[model samples]
Target: MRNAPTVRFEAITQDNWEDCVKLEVKEEQRKMVAPNWYSIIQAAYDKTYTPLSIYHEDKMVGFFMYGKDPEDGLYWIVRLMIDKRFQGRGYGEAAIRLGLELIKRQEDCSPEIVISYVPDNEAAGKLYERVGFVPTGRIVEGETEARYKVLR
Candidate 1:
């Protein structure tokens, strides 16, 4: 059996901004992600949100941002992406699980986790479902994004 990738989550910082900016998504896939990747790093560094770099065996491979939805108390996954060069290597799934684990470490945080992604991106939908995320029938910014909750 293939060994599972080792994953670690670290808060984004100035030192790591370059790594985050250097990550790329294919032209076809860019619309499905946040319009500003650099803003994600800035937000995290500015303390506006929690941005995490996903490292596999010490190499930065992916990123995720999470925070409480101001309108609701539930945890929300604001942004998630795997570097184009690192896609299809199972790093995305590992990074997601690592994010969930990190959220669980917080006190009084909701057991539920929610995420939004373009509905047309079948690959993303499959990945989310394969990892136990289900649709919540909610739409935002006129875009269809599936919401998922972690069942403990």
Candidate 2:
């Protein structure tokens, strides 16, 4: 039996930005999450948005962006997408756990962290719920809003 690769997060710097932008989801899941390039570009204009690359061992397998939402003054996991080739191997959940841990360490992090997804994205809903997020019954920009509170 083979061992699973170690998962970790790395800053999306100029050296690895291009590689991060090249990661993609499966065709049917395209609408469920924003593309890496768009998220990276969006992060550029927003200082609060910290984009990070998700790596399994030394291979970049996904992208993550978590930050404070200026409008609500709450922290959010704005984006998470594992490449099509890496889906279903537990990378998503592992990245999310690491992301949450990092978020809780932020100097200004709120007690609650938010995340949202298309109403029909069962995989996302399940994934988020499994990681401790509960739907808040609010829709933000058409996505179902959910939140996870940092437990002290």
Candidate 3:
């Protein structure tokens, strides 16, 4: 198989919040997101979660928010959204693979990664499965979530 594209994650900042805010998800898909655009951007400022700007070739194309799950010892991918304009390319997969690589590099943690999304999101389910994440048969906070692990 061809190698996934390189992706870099930079911590989110106020200067880039607008770029994230303006990210468009199809109206039909908006229901899958939590807290809406305004709340998500607001939370980013408070540092409750860490937001990462996904970049490929110096272009900002996607955003993801995540934090460590203290209970499970897994890096939780809380939010991952590609700009509507940038969707359908391979950026999502590239970004996800890069995230997994980052987890592998964390010395404090082992290679367990977990992510959750609405069950109806077929595209996300397919992407996660494509990258080796299988359903963990677990639900969190009322959302159907799946878990995946990278073998050490």
Of the two candidates 2 and 3, the one with more favorable TM-score, higher being better, is: 2
Model 1 segments more than 4 A misplaced: 41-48
Q: lDDT of all the models against the reference?
A: 0.77, 0.91, 0.75
The residue-level lDDT of candidate 1 at 116 comes to 75
Clashing pairs in 3: none
Residue range 1-152, candidate 3, lDDT tens digits: 66667778887676776776677777788888753365466554755456788877877888877767667777777878777788877888988888877767777654667888888888898899999888877777766777777677
The most accurate candidate by TM-score is 2
lDDT value, residue 104 of candidate 1: 70
Two-way TM-score contest, 1 vs 2, winner: 2
* Ordering by TM-score: 2, 1, 3
lDDT of 2 by residue, 31-144 (tens): 789889999889899898999999998899999999998888889999999999999888998889989999999888898999999998999999999989999999989999
Identify the runs in model 2 with alpha carbons over 4 angstroms from their true place: 1-5
Candidate 2 has what TM-score? Answer: 0.94
Clashes of each: 0, 0, 0
- List candidate 3 stretches off by more than 4 Å: 1-4, 35-48
Against the true structure, candidate 2 has what lDDT? 0.91
- Candidate 2: give the clashing pairs: none
